[model samples]
Target chain A: MTIKVAILGFGTVGEGVWETLHTHHEYIQKKLSTPIEITSILVKDSNKKRNLPDSVQVTTDIEEVFQQPVDVVLEAIVGKQPAYQYVTRAIEHGAHVITANKEMFAHYGPHLLELAKEHNVWIGYEATTAGGTPVIRTIDQMLQVNQIKSIQGIVNGTSNYILTQMTKHQNSFEDALLAAQQKGYAEADPSNDVDGYDAFYKAMILSQLAYQDQPNWDEVYLEGIRTISSQDIDKATIQGQKWKHVATIELRHGAPRASIQPMQLNEDHPLYNIDGVENALSIQTDLLGSITLSGPGAGKLPTASAMIEDLLYVFQKERQQEAQYV
Target chain B: MTIKVAILGFGTVGEGVWETLHTHHEYIQKKLSTPIEITSILVKDSNKKRNLPDSVQVTTDIEEVFQQPVDVVLEAIVGKQPAYQYVTRAIEHGAHVITANKEMFAHYGPHLLELAKEHNVWIGYEATTAGGTPVIRTIDQMLQVNQIKSIQGIVNGTSNYILTQMTKHQNSFEDALLAAQQKGYAEADPSNDVDGYDAFYKAMILSQLAYQDQPNWDEVYLEGIRTISSQDIDKATIQGQKWKHVATIELRHGAPRASIQPMQLNEDHPLYNIDGVENALSIQTDLLGSITLSGPGAGKLPTASAMIEDLLYVFQKERQQEAQYV
Candidate 1:
């Protein structure tokens, strides 16, 4: 059987997903038991020339792409409107959806997941959390076996990059932000990352997964590294500490409470030495104690890799269903 | 649909599996969409007053368990004798098998997997590798999406516990080993773990998953903490480095090579500060860069929890197949 996938955004992550799929087609097909093809792409500009094969149909109209028979929709697009419309349309058409859009997911993911279940499809948001770090899958599976006590980590790469630069080289926040922008770690408009909304959104996802409670984005505490100075770094350093933008969710009085702020971490913490664009999460559990996962918080290839995992999950389920009938 | 499971050992891990199944019965059923009952338990002695329900039949005869209609077999027995025979029998009997037997799997897993596939069965050995760390699950899923560049970290918890004691407290090798045994981290024999064979077997499993190549466990280079000394730790510390018994698989000359030896790592390496009984595996991939997961490598609940995940996976597949028929 063949599966068609539409990537609703032709940006860095979109290109990375395309590149990975192209490079590992045979391997992925062997694993999934069905070949997945990128048949269409929803881009801002249809005139742009990309390295994708001519068989791929690039389109600027979301409705036109939805108008076709699609099996999967990958929402790699930024922002709310058309990306949300594209995914809803795909699910309504009975196609599974995978997304790297954390901002949108944090807001309306539960409703969408309910909708997908109703349609007998799946909403895979593995790429929406901490890049390619399989954190979402781990929580959703392992939490069944163990009670999650707490979750703490650096979820924003831009914020972590800025903090690491300021702490390591004594650079001001502005210079560090500029350096991150040059490295493609930060966007041109960096409010979402530097002001800690990116991290807040990520914490929302983790909090929901950890406790099955989807908290509002504004309800969680938020603190960004935009105001951190060299003096703040030195003060933390002299006290045998380091500064990091940490997204935390813990059970406070038997209720889940979320926080995203720059905290002074001692060397004992697993996330203390997470430097540069790396992100790490310390998941405290009842059975296994503490499990910490560290990796690149955000990158083109890493984020796309998460999407590929989601696609495989979708196909694996479908294949299993087919095998059962036969 | 209903599934019947049998535990073929009443050891620490066996009891853990039973405990997790009993405690999370409703949750596991919800996840797998079926009611799983522990049909029969094969123990060395039925006289042991374990906190099990009266419905769980504890028997000393392995044949008695095989005599009953069983859908899955969870082999938690140690060593090569009855464990290997039991798993082979389970596969031949058309029963899915999940095991926490690393020694058995490392020595004979590839063959057993082939046998299971021939018989249309599955061998779930996630617990066999890194206890409840989910390293096996991560690699199994993520390898489809990305090329594994390298895998390195601490796999053997007993070895790591001894090394950490020696490094931090200047304890002798014997003292550290004693401390480990006292903490129940090391077995009475301790030969398998202290001789580096344990780590070697884990690496062999990882090597196969990373590159589909399973090097002979004996042929793989081995170096245990038996030779590690406080002086070695001091020398490494002088250079701003620390010692960790790293089981590594890197592509050398475009071929996968496995090694388990003590390595000197600076603070920047993700696996550097993983101390005590915590086990960590750093999977470096072409897509996600370096993803390091750290947690309890071996424990009753931890290892048993891994087995539950495997059982869920088995039943989840069964449910998916059943769903397809409808």
Candidate 2:
């Protein structure tokens, strides 16, 4: 079986997915038990000279890619409007959709899941929250048996990167932010990450899945790393602790109470040693106690790798279903 | 739809499963989108006084449970002979099998997986490896996209408990083992745990799923924590480290290289803070960087909770397959 995939945006993550498909094609094929082909690539400028396979139809127009038959729509597009429209349209056309749009998922996710269920297709946002980490998949499997009571996560990589630098170098947050930007871990704007919007959205997404309850978005509190001065870092260091930006949501009185803030973690805490751009989350469950999952928060290949996993999952699931009656 | 389940060996894990079914019955049903019932329970002594629901039939004759219609068999039996035979028979009888038997799974797992595939029924052994930590499920999902390059795990809870006590109280290994036995973390014959046989079996099982290649059991090197003395513990403590019995299997080239032994871990390692009977595992993947997961390694409720997840997975798969044709 050949799964036809259409890439909506050919940026860093899109290029990574494209490269992995070409580079590790044999290994992926052997594991998937099927062949997968990139049929179309959507880009900002089709005239830009880039090295790619001749078989894939590189086009500037999104409509051109949608015109072709697609089994899976690999949407690497950012933001809310077009990404949401693209995902819904692809699902409407009988194609499973894989996305890395955290903002779109956090806001309009429940409706999209309903649409996918209605269409008998899958909407995979595993890459949206924590990039390469299997935290989302782990939680999905965990929820089958254990009801998570609390979740504390260092979900924003850029904020974590900045904080880690500030603590390690004992420098100002501004300098740390600049270092993070130079390392490509942060963007020029950096507001979504440093202002806690990114982690807020991710926490919302996690709450939806873990609790199956939509929290009042306005009620969830958030604080960024901008307020953590060098003096504060020194105090935490003196107290044998490190400052970490955490996104947390816990069940209090059977309802979820959420917050995003900087925490002074002691040595015994699992998130204490999770420095640099490393992300870690601890889920306190009724039966399983405290389970911590940590990894690289985001990267080009890591995020793309998550999308690749979703693509394979769709095909494998269909195959199993098909094999059941045969 | 109501799914009928049978329980084999009403021991600690088996009783825990039964209790979870009764306690979290409503929540599980809602999540699974179907009601599940325990139809029969096979025990060593059927006449033993125990409080259970009137609906569940307790029996000593395993044949009686086989004769009755079963959709899934929950095998919590330990050891090799009868558990293996029961699982094979259940699969043959068109009932999906869920097992928490590590020894049996380590030896005959591949054969049983083939049997389940051939019979078009699911065989889930998630509880067989790391209890309720969801490592098996995570690895199962991870292999779809990420090729695990290496694994570092504190897999055995009893070994971890002994080591934790020895380091904390500066006690001898013998005294620690006695304390662990009193705490129910270790069996009276804790040779399987302290001798690293338990972790060895888990590593073999992990290699089977993660690599899809059978590692020769005899070729796999094993070292127990019994050799570690108080002086060794003091040495590790002076070096700002701790001793953890870890089951590690890494892909050296394209094949698996595995070993189970005590390792002195530094402070920054995620597994360092994993004390007591807690377990932590880190999977280094080709695309996804180092992802670490930690939780309760084993317990009555935790192990049984893993079996519950497997039970739900089996039902969910069946539902998806049934929906495909409709």
Candidate number with greatest lDDT: 2
lDDT of 2 by residue, B1-326 (tens): 68989999999999999999988999899877888888999999867899977877889888899777899999999899899998999999999999999999999999999999899898889899878899998888878777789898999999999999999998899999999999998989999999999998899898988888756677788999999999999999999999888888987768788999999999777688888988888898889888888888888898999999999887888788897788
User: Model 1, A38-104: lDDT tens per residue?
Assistant: 7889999888877777788888988778776689988899877777877888899998999999988
lDDT at A160, model 2: 91
Interface RMSD in Å per candidate, to 1 decimal?
A: 1.5, 1.2
- Which DockQ values do the candidates obtain, in the order shown? 0.73, 0.76
DockQ for model 2 equals 0.76
Off by over 4 Å in 2: A253-255
Candidate 2 residue pairs in clash (backbone atoms < 3 Å) = none
Candidate number of the best DockQ: 2
Ten-residue segment with the worst summed lDDT in candidate 2 chain B? B212-221
Which docking class does model 2 fall in?
medium
Residue A252 CA displacement from its true place in model 1, Å: 4.2
